[model samples]
Target: MKKTNIFKIAFILTIGLASIFSSCKKDAGPAGPQGAQGAQGPQGLQGTPGPAGSTVLSGNGTPTSTTGANGDFYLDLTSSLFYGPKTAAGWGTGFAMKGANGAAGTNGNKIINGTTIPGATDGSIGDYYLNTTNYLLYGPKIASGWGVGTSLIGTANVKYSGWATSTDPINVGYGKTSIRSARINTTAITPAIINSGVVLVYARRNSDLILPGGTTPLPFSYDLSVVENIKATVNFSLGTSVIYINTTTSNNSLYAEATLEYRYVVIPGGVAIAAAKNINLNDLQAVEKYFNIEK
Candidate 1:
């Protein structure tokens, strides 16, 4: 009976050992293969800079253009721009001074500055000078007249005064006189200014300035008081006389005469042309020799 029991126990132990070996074999598994790589991710966004950065004009805050001279009305600034004529608001002020009469000042008059005395005629009439250094300067007077047509005619062989300089030197005639200093004489030869007449003034280039005309002939009367220089001519076409006036450049058509009236024509070289007195077209040849015409 002991031998039988030993054999049964040995059988049971072998069964348990075999079962444990079988379970260990079942727990073991096969190895897996390598997996494929994934696609690349999207790029990250850029970060902003810190504060205290420089500001620039980025938007369409376009600059405006200025017009002509009238467009000078705006100002430009570094950071921004603005227009001129700036207005101010909310204003206040406070200041005051008390007067006290002290010792009486010297019993005399205080000379104010730049005071021009009236009727200060010490300066010769027609003399041009600046009250101050910056003021305009001119020479003595050569003529004076009132109205638009008043004039001054120089004496033969003699130049007018007021300019202080001899006519022979300048060769240029005296211009219009300034009435501010000397008064005008509104006589028979009154200037046109009195009756819608145009006021003109000019200087002769040489003595030949007042020449006679080819057709019409008349007397030319001018002011003698204000002429600076002059030269007498031998033109006999001016049957009566010739006068050179200081007139404007545009008044060149003053040489006209009616029938039975003396005809005068202003010619080139400042010469006034006129016909001989009482000389008809038939007798023109006789007196023509006396007047000295090229024909």
Candidate 2:
């Protein structure tokens, strides 16, 4: 009877163990649906500010109703500063210094009417003015009342012998004078002469006078010889003063005769000459037509 009880207890224990193993075993199947997504994280911090840019012109600060006169207007910039057209009051507290003026607009050619030429006192040099009285156009005035129509003329002469050394003063019929003098010889190419007045000298061989040189020389030959072919240099002084002529020569065979020509004009008091005008090209065309240079 105890042996029968032991066997029954063993069978009961084995069945209980099999039931536990079957309950733990799992069968393969599809995965369950994924869970819902989680919420997003908090926002990031803000970035730093960027560098400033170049200043820009905003607008004219002057009132809209009034046109800006030279010193009345100021310019506004992106930085909120005011710059100017400087006035006597200057750029005050809120304003920056004045800026340079803008480029000037182009001007048209000037036109003059009539012949009563405008007096020199009337306009600036290079400014053109017309004379209404005469039909002629007068301009490019050099001095008071010294316009295109005025002129003076005169004549004079001087004679020198080859033996003369130094200079001889000559009084040309004109009131003009001499300022300088020089001489040119066969050996030298140039002579020193003055800037004013026209003086021309002619040299000629006087007779067949020969010093210590060969005979039968070539005619009109300007060479180094006993009869030196010397030429006179002449110059005149300012305003009807004195004129000088170089008359020195190594030989006595050369003689010189000079002729003088001069011209001048008288200017009226307080009547200055006008300067050339931009219209001078047209004026020149008219002048050329008047002189028959252009048909």
Among the numbered candidates, top lDDT falls to 2
TM per prediction: 0.12, 0.19
What Cα-based lDDT does every candidate model obtain? Answer: 0.28, 0.36
Best by TM-score: 2
Count residue pairs with overlapping backbones in model 2: 21
* Local error of candidate 2 at residue 41 (angstroms): 26
Model 2, 1-295: lDDT tens per residue? 9999999999999999998887767544678999999999999999998864333233645323233433544456443556444445554444545566799986643545544545556544444555544334455444564255211111111111222222344233212222224322221111222232222222223333421232211111333443445432322222222323332333332243232212111112221122122112123232222222312
Q: Per-residue lDDT tens digits of candidate 1, residues 70-102?
A: 222333333234332222421112122234558
